[model samples]
Target: MTIVLHGIRNCDTMKKAFAWLDGQGLDWRLHDYKKEGIDRARLEGWVAKLGWEALLNRAGTTFRKLPDAEKAGLDAGKAVALMLAQPSMIKRPVAVAGEALLVGFDPARWSATLK
Candidate 1:
């Protein structure tokens, strides 16, 4: 099975994930939402499974730099809107394999999930 890793190309976490996936000899491809962008339907599906809070990178520079009003009172819809406009605001290295969706990189978790 091929795993699709979604994130920006320059992110440190994505770099690590790429190295790890390569070490494991897995067939993986990058989604690079920063360049390609993510669609509402797919984003909504991920939110349904992973929850928007988990998918949004609130701690990231992009989110932190947002105006106060933009960060306040966020819901799934608003969060989706923000992420759609700035895909970098979404969490890094979200790995998808068939029906499985992983929000962040964890070597142990990934090994188990891929197995």
Candidate 2:
């Protein structure tokens, strides 16, 4: 399986996710969103699959720093636009493999979904 992992390289969660994937012997491509920049189309696609609430990382500093107005009244389109503008606002370790896309890395979920 060809997997594309997306996140900032220095993020602790992302670091763990990458280490786990490596230990699992999976060959994957890392899409460092901070460096490569996220595309609108791809962000929209993730929003379609996971919903805006799931895709957006409200727990992250990036999201916390956003103005209150921007955080409220968000639909998929609005959320996608925000994510495109600030990739760090998206959840960590978004993995795309074939037609399956995953948001965040829970070990059990990763084992079941990716295995």
Candidate 3:
């Protein structure tokens, strides 16, 4: 099975995830969303499985830079739209391993699920 890890290359969380993956000796490819851009269909699929709230990165600078009005009214559709426009606004290191989709870098969860 192919595992695709999506995030910005420079992100510290991504770096940790990469290190973890390397240490585990797992084969995976990194998809730099900032460089390649994100696909709406794939984003929507992740949202469908993980929920928009899970995918949205409200703690990030990109999300913080948005106007107050934009942050106030966030339904799934709006959140997905925002994420599509700004891929950085999506959480770091979204890894897809076979049929399983993982968001964020949880070493414990990775060990349980990916390993």
Mark the 10 consecutive residues where model 3 has the least summed lDDT: 1-10
Q: What lDDT tens digits, residue by residue, belong to model 3 across residues 41-107?
A: 9998998898999999999999999999999989889998999899999999999998989999999
TM-score of 2: 0.94
Candidate 2, residues 1-115, lDDT tens digits: the string is 8789999899999889999989999888899987899988888877877788999889888889889999889888888888889999999889998888889989889888888
Tell me the tens digit of each residue's lDDT in model 1 across 1-115. 9999999899999999999999999999999886788999999999989889999999999999999999999999999999989998999888999998998889999999986
> What are the runs in model 1 whose C-alpha is more than 4 Å off?
none
How does model 3 fare in lDDT?
A: 0.93
- TM-score on alpha carbons, each prediction: 0.96, 0.94, 0.97
Which numbered prediction scores highest in lDDT against the true structure? Answer: 3
Cα lDDT, model 2, residue 99: 85
How are the candidates ranked when ordered by lDDT, highest leading? Answer: 3, 1, 2
